[model samples]
Structures are given as C-alpha cells and as structure tokens.
Target: MKYRSESILLLACAALASACGGPDGDNSEAPSPEAAEQDAAGPASNDMPDTAPAETGEASGDHEEADDDHAHEAAEGGRLESHEHGHAMLAVTLQDSMLSVSFEAPLSSLGAPEDPQNAEDEARIEAMLEDFRNDETIISLQGDAGCEIVSTSTGTRLVSGHGEMQLDYDFDCENAGGLEGVRFGGFDQYPALLSIEAVFVSDTQQMATELSAASPELKIQ
Candidate 1:
C-alpha cells in the first residue's frame, strides 16, 4: 500500500508539470505580421531629413514671389488697378497774356518703376516740380507774365494768371497735363496764352521748356 501511494503522488506531480508547459496553457497570443512589420519599420517618433535641393529652391522661389507681390501692392497706393496708358489731360483757358499753369499725374495709372534707377529718375522729376512751385523766379513770372498756383495735390494743381493779359490755366484736361505731357513739349505752344504740357519720360529738355514757358523772359541764374 505504501508503494502505491508514492506512485500516485509522482503521477499527479508529472501531470501538473505537463499542464503548465503546454502550448495553449499560458493564454498569450503571438505577434501578428502587421505588428511585426511596424516594429521592424522603426519607432513612430523618428523624423527623416529632407534630401532634395530642388524642393528647397522651390520654397525659396515662392517666398521671393510673395515678397515681390507685397512690395508692388504697397508701392501702388495699397491696391491693384488697371492703368491708363499714354495721355495726360490739361485744361487751358486764356484770361490775359499771363498764362496760369496747373498740372497733375494719373495716380491710378502711375506704376512703381521696376528698376531702382528708374525709380530715382521719377523721384528727381517730382523734386523738380516741387522746386518750380517754390521758385522765386517762377513766381515772379506769374506776376510779370501773370500765373500762379492757387492749389495743388498729388493728382491736381490749380493756377490763376494775371498780368498785361489775364490767362487762366486749368490743366484738368485728358492727355494734356500728365507726366508724359510734362516731360515732353508736345503741347508747349498756344498763341497769346501759354498752354504748356509736358510728359515725364527720360528727357530733361521738358524741364527747360517748362522753366522758359513759366516766365518767357526770366534768366535761369
């Protein structure tokens, strides 16, 4: 009887050991193919560096374009509008021998010059106009020949002439008093009343003509 009990105890121990070591005993599942693949692919937190110079170049180009557009809009009075081409309007009326001159630029049509040199040129022209307005000689001409600036703005100038002959210049006519007309002597001659118009396009001769016309006989000293 002692030998039989010992045998039964050994058998029970063997069965418990087999059950613990069985394939389905632990209740754990094997890794799926997809999970294995993701592990092999590396961690989700890693970021790779960009390798293409072309992509960098494209990004730079886009930035430059945006900057250019911004500059153009800013220079163009804060908006984009269609420009009128090739014509300045001026209104000329004769009251006496003295000629009153009024002038203006088409702000809507005036574009920001693309080249820096060209921009400087435009600025010089603008300065010349301002100088003319403040010139004692030019003012004297209006008194002698009879003309004066009554009012002025970026887009317009009003002048009244009074001398031997009263001449009024209301240069608000189309294609008669623009930058082009102010720079070129295309419309500098007008009988008893001096109807002068100049266009501002590369030539300085218009400035000379304008000074001469302003005071027909004033010396440029």
Candidate 2:
C-alpha cells in the first residue's frame, strides 16, 4: 500500500506540472517533477513509520472523486509558480507514517522587503525565516499522531527583482493510522499572506484547495 501511494503521488504531480504550464509552456518554469517527488519521498526512506491503513469500498471512491476535483482546480488557476503577492503555494503528502510539506511564497507576502539593503532589512528576513522554522507557528498536525520533525530545508532567491522563499519539512509519525488534517498557523503570524493554494496527497486521497487567513486547514484521510 505504501509503494502504491508513492506511485499515485508521482502521477498526480506530473499531471499538476502539465496543467500548471502556460499556453507556450512559459509558466511551467518551477521545480522539476523529480525534485517534487524527492520532497515527497525523502524522509520515508529513513526509518519513517508505516501505519496508515489501506482504503477500500466507499473510501476508494471518495479518493478518486477528490482527485478529479483537484485536477479541475489545477486546470483553472493553480500554477507551479503561483508567484503572486499575498499568495503562496503549499504541497503536502502523507505516505506510510511520513508527512512531507513543500511551501513557496514571495518574501514580501510575509511583510519583509523584497530586497534587503541594510541590517534592519536583513533582520526582518531572518525573523520571518525563524517563524517559518517553528512548526507551531507554521502548521499543526494532530497530537495523537506522535509526529516529530525529521528534517527541514529552506532558502531564498530573487527573480525579476522579487524575493521568493521555499521551505520544506518532513515528519516521522509514530502512529498515522488516524491522522486526518493539518492546519496552517501562519495566518496571524504573517497577516500579509492572504491566501495559499494547497495540495494534499495521502495514501488514499489526492486533494487540492485554496486557503485564506479566514480558513487555513487542509484535511486528508
């Protein structure tokens, strides 16, 4: 079941990438599918637990329906490089007992200047990054899952004079059988961020939704 989930995730991501491209493929210039897959599966290879239950009957049907809806959403407006101000892109996947997250956004969306010119500007950037590094300040997983952060990677870059940042996280959950949802905790912390285009892939479900400071939770079973 775990291996099957990985395969499904790869296919879903491929479709997402294709759908994210512009007419001339100019808008598809984001991370490669390979890199996305690595983020999805990286922590699983290490001693990550495998406790999620397999889906059957109506659960399987619901999963398929979710995937179809997600495809439609992607075709409409979700882009690989959703670089709009006050907006960000977030991806989450739960395979076995490992949960991985990939997040990207414009630095200005977090209330930081695009280009840091002095120590004050630099300090602001660092402060925002520190907030991002705190799981409690960024997102929340169910406590019963016994999840612990396994790894994290973050970086910043500039494109066309706009500063952008990416943050990736992996968690090892001792018991993920009933893990169901994650809630974003950054809304109040970074009020400048207005929305997040999010995707969630689990052992039996593929879901996508748009989130706002008003509503910031992604539920996956």
Candidate 3:
C-alpha cells in the first residue's frame, strides 16, 4: 500500500511534466495508457494506525501500542502538509490559522550535468533559467542573495540563516502554483537550494500585524 501511494505521487509528477509538453515536445513520449491503467489499480496507503488488540502480558507489545497511540495523536493534533515540486521538498505547519512554509534539500545531493568548469555546464545552468521562468512553482526575482521581493505587491522581505544557504523565495499566491498542484520528479536535474519566504492573509489581522511588527533586521529590498 505504501508503494501504491508513492507510485501515485510519481505519476502525478509525470502528468505535470506532460502538461507542459513531454520531454522533447513529443506527446507520445508520455507514459503509456497501460501504465496509467495499472497505476489506477494500485491501493492507497493507509496513513492511520492499525487497530489490532495488544498482547496483555508482553511489555514489548504494550510499548509498541503506546508508541502507535502517540503517533496517531500527533498526526491528529497537527497538520503535516508536504509537497515535492521542482526537486525541492516543501513542508508547512499551520498553527491557529497561520502558515509557515519551509523549503529544503541536501546540497550534496545536487549533481552537475557535467564538470562545473565546463562551458556546457554554464549553458545548462543558463537553460535552467528558462525553466525557472516557465515553472509556475517558483517566483522570479532580479536581486542578489540576502534580500529580495517576496512578491511585487506583498512587498520585499529579508531571509534568515547564512553561508552556503539556499536562496530565499517569496511565493506569489496569484501567479505561483499551489503546493498541491506541483508536479514531482521533474526537478532532478537542478541544484538543491532551500530558502523560504512567507506571507499571511487571514480573517484575524493580529497575526500579520505581529509578524510585521516583529520584523527581523534582514532587509528584503
């Protein structure tokens, strides 16, 4: 069942890539109809814990049951939202209606298409800019590292952390795609850099007011 969910996520990513035109602009290059049919037959992975009764006298069994209960409680207590798009892991925690988005990746995991010193490597990097522009997932910017616009209207913002860190990103709600809408696996060729930028809009303005008032020293412009 776990494998089934993983496969579904993979297919979701493939569909996303295909929507933009398959690799080389050939629609025929997309996954075959038979593959999609097989995927549909796959069962969904159960996220909930098992309900079997525990053994009465075994300490180990009791401990296991307790752990499972704790896990179920944790899962129910919080929202664990995650999305993989453009080869990056995006997770968010929503507390009291406020949302915090975190983007992450392992730097060592990113591979260069060729030697970084090669001209072709530079060309590949350049070509990626086009992909970035086309990617509805990433927001574009014209500034250097440290600080930049989160969005043209929402205003610029500063980033935390330092040294060999991922570039901070300000996602545009209107233009940027939602976390759930992103396609997975298509970003395998890009570098792994993680950075985050956040915006708060809600019925209660207190959260945004406090966040704005407690603004960090980092500049966004």
TM-score, per-candidate, Cα-based? 0.21, 0.63, 0.25
- lDDT (Cα, tens digit) per residue for candidate 3, span 1-221: 11123333333334333333434655555463235424544444222000001101111100011133565544422111122221223322222322223323222223323123467754553344333334433432222222212321111111111001122233323322222211122233343422222222222211111111123111222
Give the Cα error of residue 97 in candidate 3, in Å. Answer: 9.4
Q: Candidate 3: where are CA atoms >4 Å away?
A: 1-88, 91-115, 137-149, 152-167, 172-221
Model 2: which ten-residue window has the lowest total lDDT? 55-64
Which order, best to worst by lDDT?
2, 3, 1
The per-residue C-alpha lDDT of model 3 at residue 30 equals 49
lDDT of each: 0.24, 0.58, 0.26
**lDDT by residue (tens digit), candidate 2, 1-221:** 12123432453455444343456655554565444444555645311000011110110000011133654444322222335678776677777787777676778888988767788977887667666654354766644777776766666655445576676667788887767777677888788988877777664567777778777877665
Comparison by TM-score, 1 against 2, better one: 2
- lDDT by residue (76-128, candidate 1, tens digit) is 32111111222222222222222223232222212322122356745643443
Q: How accurate is candidate 3 locally (lDDT)?
A: 0.26
**What is the Cα-based TM-score of model 3?**
0.25
* CA RMSD per model (angstroms): 40.5, 15.5, 21.4
